[model samples]
Target: MHVPDGFINAPVSAVAGVVAAGAVAVSLKGARRELNERTAPLAGLVAAFIFAVQMLNFPVAAGTSGHLLGGALAAILVGPFTGILCISVVLLMQGILFADGGLTALGVNILDMGVVTSVVAYALFRGLVRVLPRTRRSMTAASFVAALISVPAAAVAFTLMYWIGGTTDIPIGKVFTAMVGVHVLIGIGEAAITALTVGAVVAVRPDLVYGARGLTAPLKLRIDGELVDAPAPAPAREPAAAHRSTKGLWATGLVTALVLAGFVSYYASANPDGLEKVATDQGIDKKAKDHASKDSPLADYGVKDVSNARISGGLAGIIGVGATLVVGSGAFYVVSRRRTDDESVNSDSRRDEKV
Candidate 1:
């Protein structure tokens, strides 16, 4: 849920900002491992895709609508650290360009949506997958359950935050009940979309799914009529970890994300999402402040010069895709470089000792 600028008080917003900043900093370090040659580039696409999908608001209740929070989907497809980065990127873009999330409340949105959802969902998904059957079906099933829970978990987080920093004097218990109840319905849509997308991708290329990396059973061979385990291979392809060239997957994913955000975002549903609806209904919008960038040319996804909604939104979405890729890819490249440097230093030390 994108909380606008005025809903949360200054103290709460400032605290959230620090927390969000810290989270991004930590994720940058964690992402060094998560964003490799394959996943680094893929991370940007994940952000863009989440942005596009978020545009499609599914009806959660009679009036309230819900959209993909995308934490579970990103975590399952990418890794948890990168997933947080991905969603945070979208939130940042939306806040600055689209006048969506408030700049002042950026930390709150990131903490509530990015940190809580990704970390909680990934942890649950990993725990369930560890004990469940080692099948793609099981992976998809776990994704569904994890996604289902993450939404409500986010709602709870928000409720707690509001209890602390909420501008209104409304009872905390009522707010919690309302927030959780509406979000439960919203979670279903999230779970279904996550499960289907994960299942389809896993079926096509399980190798690309970060959460499924070690979960797949080895490919069994059929010798004549008997079932047999394949013979072990040389170190070129170590069984210790089945490493695949992430380059191909990264390219394909990036291309798909560009197509979706640049060309396909035009078709996304135009409606207020769950948080927006609740805020309006609960009168939380009374104190909301105007976005600082509301005057920006591209504010609300409309390019200043473009008159056509179709063209304007399309162009903005495309620009976002390109920008996110460039920035995200650069961040990831730095991490990859550090990782390589560390590995090289280690290798050099061993050689020096031998010499």
Candidate 2:
């Protein structure tokens, strides 16, 4: 959930800022390995997709609603390091542009929503995939479980942070209970969305899904009472097929993201999210202050001076998707370029050694 300002004390907020900074730094390095020519552009699409889906908040309880955290979905579709960066990009955009999350509490939101969920979800998904059958169905099933757990994990993380630097004197146990309870229900929605999205991607182009990599292989046959892996087949329209496949998938994904944010978001729940609901109910938001960008044209996911609610929200959502795609793609492109350069340098060094 997006943590607003005033919920956490300044000291704890500062600590979270440092932690968030360190995690981003580490992820940047790790992402060098994750993002290559094929996956780099896909990483940007993942960020934009997450930004879109998050706008469609579904009802979780009487008044609480939940949205895609994107940690599990991103990690399954892209890579974990890149997934963290994706969610971070969305959070950053929402904070500065939409005022959805507080600038002062950016670190808290990043740590809970980006770092905790991505790390936990990816680790669990990897473990489950190792034990379960190595099929697309198993991968999707594992994605669901990973996403289901990640939400509550994020809730627990927030509860601990609040215990340490809560602005109010709400009992930690009660806060934890409420936060976990609502988020547990929210997690089910997260799981279903993750599984469905991952399944869809795997169905169309399993090669594009990062988690499914290395899971599929050529079948083996028994010959002379011994089983041997099938020989690799000759290439068939290899380059043309790849070019067309990636182009089609990219076009389809971008179109889907635009549609979800620009049109479908209008029907999303208007209620507060899991964290916000818990905070309000527990008096944790008693000291919440106004967002710094509350007066901005695009604040609160609406265009300034736009009387039509639909038009205002639709424009804001479109702008958000476009901005996220540009920024996130630019970031991932740089990381991918760095990886290419490093590999080239290594190859040169090896050749010189042989010479």
Candidate 3:
């Protein structure tokens, strides 16, 4: 959930800001390993996709609604480092451009929404992969479980943060119960999206999915008497993409995101998300402050010129898609370039040593 300004007190918010800064710093280095020629571009689109899916708030309870948190989906599709960066970029864009999340509470949002979910989801996914059958189905199963846990983990994290630096005097137990209860329902939705998305990618292009790197078990061979493990074959220099038309995938994905955010949001459940619902129900939202971007021309996804909220929202949705792609592609490009340079240096060093 996007934590608005003033929900958390100044000191706790500052601590979260520092934590968020450190996470981003670590991700920059970690991304050097994750981003490759193939994955870098896809990572950006993953961010936009997350942003889009988040707009479609499915009904969780009678009133409460939940949306995709996307940490597991991103981590399964891309790499963990890039997944964190993807979510971080979405959070940044939402805060500054859409005025959805709070400026002052940006750190809180990043730490809970970015750091908690990515770290937990990836860690769990890896652990499950080791024990589960090494197959695409197993990967999807792991993704579902990982995503399910990550959502509640975020809710718990927020509850803890609120207890420490809550602007209001609401009891900690109440926050915990409410946050956990609502987010549990939300987690189911996240799990479904993550499993389906991971399954789809792994079905077509398992090579492109970072989490499925070693999913195919090594072949066992037998000659004459005893069975032996076959030596691993070298990967092809350049594997052809499974699909004949990537243009279709891109078009379908982008269109789905735009439709979800711009038009479908109109039908989204009106109940506040887990965080907002808990905060307001428990009186924590009393201290919430107006977003700094309140005066901006595009505040709340409504364009200035478009009288129809639908048209204004639709235009903003398209703009968000373009912006996320542009920024995400640019960031991943730098990461990919650095990776290339490192590989070159390593190769040269090995040659010199051998000489």
Per-residue lDDT value at 54 in model 3 = 81
- TM match of model 3 to true structure: 0.90
Candidate 2: regions farther than 4 A off: 215-237
| lDDT by candidate, in order shown | 0.80, 0.89, 0.82
What is the C-alpha lDDT profile of model 1 across 118-216, one tens digit per residue? Answer: 998999999998888666667788999999999999999999989998997777887888889989988999999899988867655565678866655
Clashes of each: 0, 0, 0
Q: lDDT at 270 for candidate 1? A: 63
lDDT of 2 by residue, 252-350 (tens): 999999999999999999999999899888899999989998888999999999999999999999999999999999999999999999999999999
Ten-residue region with minimum lDDT total, candidate 1: 227-236
Residue 353 of model 1: what lDDT? 100
Cα-based lDDT at residue 253, candidate 1? 67
User: Model 1 Cα RMSD, Å?
Assistant: 3.9
Off by over 4 Å in 1: 215-248
**Candidate 3 lDDT tens digits, 191-259:** 999999887766555556787566557423344665544433325652443232344455666777777
Deviation in Å, model 3, residue 336 alpha carbon: 1.1
By lDDT, the better pick of 2 and 3 is 2
